[model samples]
Target: MSGAAIALEGVARTFPGGAQAVRPCALVVPQGEILGLLGPSGCGKTTLLRLIAGLERPDPGGRVLFDGRDVTRLPVEARHVGMVFQSYALFPNMTVAGNVGYGLRVRGVRRAEIAARVEEVLALCDASALASRRVDQLSGGQRQRVALARAVAVRPRVLLLDEPLSALDAALRERLRDELATLLRRFAITAVFVTHDQAEALAIADRVAVMRAGRIVQADTPRALYAAPADAWVARFVGGAADLGGVVSDGSLLLPGGRLPAPGPHAPRARFLVRPGGLDLADRSEATLVGAVTRATFLGDRLRVEIDGAAEGALVVDAAPDAAAAPGARVGLRLRPGGLIVVPEAEEAP
Candidate 1:
């Protein structure tokens, strides 16, 4: 089945006692593309999904559309959208095949057709061999595969995944994450996946929408978001330990030790962001900082150095493990032009 187009216009949700769970949020998911809603806990990613599924009503004027047709008033069953929750949510007594076939049977599909469709999805998920096994007997990854197969067995126009990988072990989660991405693309299904994991969203989403306090702060390709965050909050959230602090003045970085040409455009009074990988130990007269290595850790191909004398926080630089400077040795640090992200200063930068 071809993918459906999804649009949310001014969708908002307000809980009782004056809690605005979701602001007026708008987004469009094109046919055959994956859009990820990424944020920390209590950011309303699940609430937004429930809104689109018709399980929760939008505040007064909000609307949800699928394929350019208003579906705000339609019930969940009428929308033909498939959902896979964090829990596999399979019936306890059902075998793998039975769980996968339940949805088809609900729609009144013929008995023979339900069997054929179940077999088809089982093969797609590489779980055909486990068709007769009970859900209780399946491993975590196997259960996830069965859940996904059940969602797609009815040829849904749109798919929604709510933290489906959060329950698995790290290795299984990674494997299933890749598998899910491939399956979505192969079926050409429009999908919205909600996750609190930065790596998971960056790895699987075609475009990621970073949410904060009930609103979308930024939406862009993963590389772009990491390389160029719109503000300090986004930079800190997406960049993790890579967030660097510096002041900008007259097209230069006024670092603690010295000055260097600012990497990007910035307000006269603005803070700068530099990724750890963007800073290197370079020999230059204009290098902004001179710090003594207080600690160093070998990280496979790279070394993480903790330096003192430049700023209050550690200056983490990536270098060849063998090239790491000796502890207590002084090193000059330089910021690469492409490494900096200039954010306008606000009491609280958006």
Candidate 2:
């Protein structure tokens, strides 16, 4: 299926009773790519999707575009966008085939054409055997597939998904997340998905737009964003960050374990960011700081160890499972030069 380019220009929406949602926002989703709108609850992800879908309109100058054509004032029905809700809104009375054919039927398609489309969708979902089954008989994952098949049956210009996988269990969600990612690529559809699941967004999306408090904090590829977040919020939001506070003096970072070279652009006394994997045990003879391993968690192939390094605080470090010291073992930290992420010093107490 062909995809459409989607763009949002200074979109803003305010609901009744003074609930301000989706502050003036501008984003462009390229053709044939999935862009995830990800954030915590009430962060305006859904509001942004609604603005693009024409379900809710932004005030006068807030423009929406499809393939560079202004469609800000177009009604929802006229926009020809496909939307899949979190609930998988299939009618209980309708069979799988019937549910898949609903959109085409609404467009006044002939019975023969509707039959052909339903079969095509059933083949697409690999649910041809369940075509006659009622929605009540299908499992959670099956229902979600049906919902996706229904959304794409009519060949929409753009597909909007609102937490489509939240309803499934952990195992199924993970499996179907991969399936959905493959399906999106195979179908070549332009999609904007709103999700609170960071892993889901990071895994499936071609690009992720991280949202915070009605504003887009950052938008970038998964690898670049995770490796180098634009700010502290993006860093912490993406994963649990272990902060090691230190001061820069005499052209080196003053850490618990002697002075070390600083990384990146920053002022003195900046917070250096390091993922657990960025550290290793420094040779004892060269080590200047000492700490005991307080805890160790074995995660498959690696061990996450929490060490109280120096007076600053306990730091979590990742080590090979076979290489980890026992709990309460005295250990020293070795910060790699490129592993440090430097941020400016916080404002002085006023």
Q: What lDDT score belongs to each candidate, Candidate 1 first? A: 0.83, 0.82
- Residues 1-350, model 2: lDDT tens digits: 47799988988888877676888889999898899999989988999998999999896679999999999989999999888889998999899999999999999999999999889877887778888999999999999889988988999999999998999999899999999998778768999999999999998999999998888878998887787776666766786556666776655667674555663356434566666766776666776556788888888788888887542667777887776577888877776555666544443211
The deviation in Å at residue 288 for candidate 2 is: 6.1
All models, RMSD in angstroms: 2.4, 3.0
Q: What is candidate 2's CA lDDT for residue 65? A: 93
- TM-score top scorer: 1
Tens-digit lDDT string for candidate 1 (109-209): 99999999999999998889989998899999898889889888988889888898998999888888888888877767888889999988998999999
Give the C-alpha miss distance for residue 124 in model 2, angstroms: 1.9
